[model samples]
Target: MTGSIDRFDEVVDEAWGRAFRGRPLADRVFYLASELGDFSVLWLIIAAAQGLRSDADADESIRLSLLLLAESILVNQGIKRLVRRPRPAATEPRPHHVRQPGTSSFPSGHASSALAAAGIMSHRHPRAAPLYYGLAAVVATSRIHVKVHHASDVVVGAAIGIGFARLAARVWPPPGER
Candidate 1:
């Protein structure tokens, strides 16, 4: 069973490789899917929502948005500090991807942010839950597709994100109409 699972993981990785495989250019762009795990996407989403705030929903939006952002930072930073696991490329003899400058690479920030966004959006706004989670899946797959993180790393990071977001929501409930 373990061997089969590992083989499946490699097969999935290979399928992705074939789908996006190309010159270094193609590899580089496909590699960018890993970027989705970074904090930039979270900031962009927050900024866009903030920009479209209305007179009534403005307060609510700001409150939830701030909470989400804070939670993301806390979870991402805390896990990295705690795990400090090295990137696969650094340790493995035949790493899937190139080495990055970061010291550790246990839980991907990109995965964390994606998971947090998915969780918060899913709970705070049920209508957008599917979309947020769908996007999160894509980003998570991209990290593995790019070979920057392992399947387990993405999984754990996402779990952390969702957990943190849930905790934040309880700690700071969204604003209700007064």
Candidate 2:
């Protein structure tokens, strides 16, 4: 079973690598998105921007930031340690420079953090849910496009992130919900 899954992952990863690894526009977009997702910088920037709107927005932003921190620690430090999966090797020369994270690639920290942030932000800014999820999708998929994670890794990481956000919402609630 595990072998089959690994084979599937390899096939998909190779396909994605062939499709987008060398394209100029795709390289630029995915690379930028991947960079923005590093350490959840893009999400943090969004949270900071949201804070500038009003006191209520600021409160939500704080909650989102805190959740992101916890999510990062849990995913990057705790879960990645348990999984200990190595990142995908570059089969072909990369067209653009991309950061190679040292952590396990079973569950992408970038994807996990991105989805978690998106889920939380969506609750507070329901109208902007599309934007939140769209950014999350990009950040999550960028891991595969940049050849740092398997497709399964990103998918599972995204699931973990969504689950974490749901659990957080129940425990902490959003600003208005409480």
TM-score of each: 0.70, 0.95
| Best-matching candidate per TM-score | 2
Relative to the true structure, candidate 1 reaches a TM of 0.70
State the lDDT of candidate 1 residue by residue for 50-85, as single tens digits.
Answer: 548665356655665676567656655676778776
**lDDT tens string, model 2, 1-178?**
8798799888988787778777899889999999999989999898999799999989888888889989989988899999898888877787777888888988988889989998998887789999999999999999989889988899899999999989999999997798
Pairs of residues at least 3 apart in sequence or in different chains that clash in candidate 2 = none
- The per-residue C-alpha lDDT of model 1 at residue 52 equals 82
Question: Worst 10-residue stretch by lDDT in candidate 1?
Answer: 90-99
Q: How much is 107 displaced in model 1, in angstroms?
A: 1.2
Instruction: Show model 1 residue runs off by greater than 4 Å.
Output: 1-33, 90-103
Q: What TM-score does candidate 2 reach?
A: 0.95
Error of 2 at 114 (Å): 0.9
Please state the error at residue 21 of candidate 2 in Å: 2.3
lDDT of 1 at 144: 69
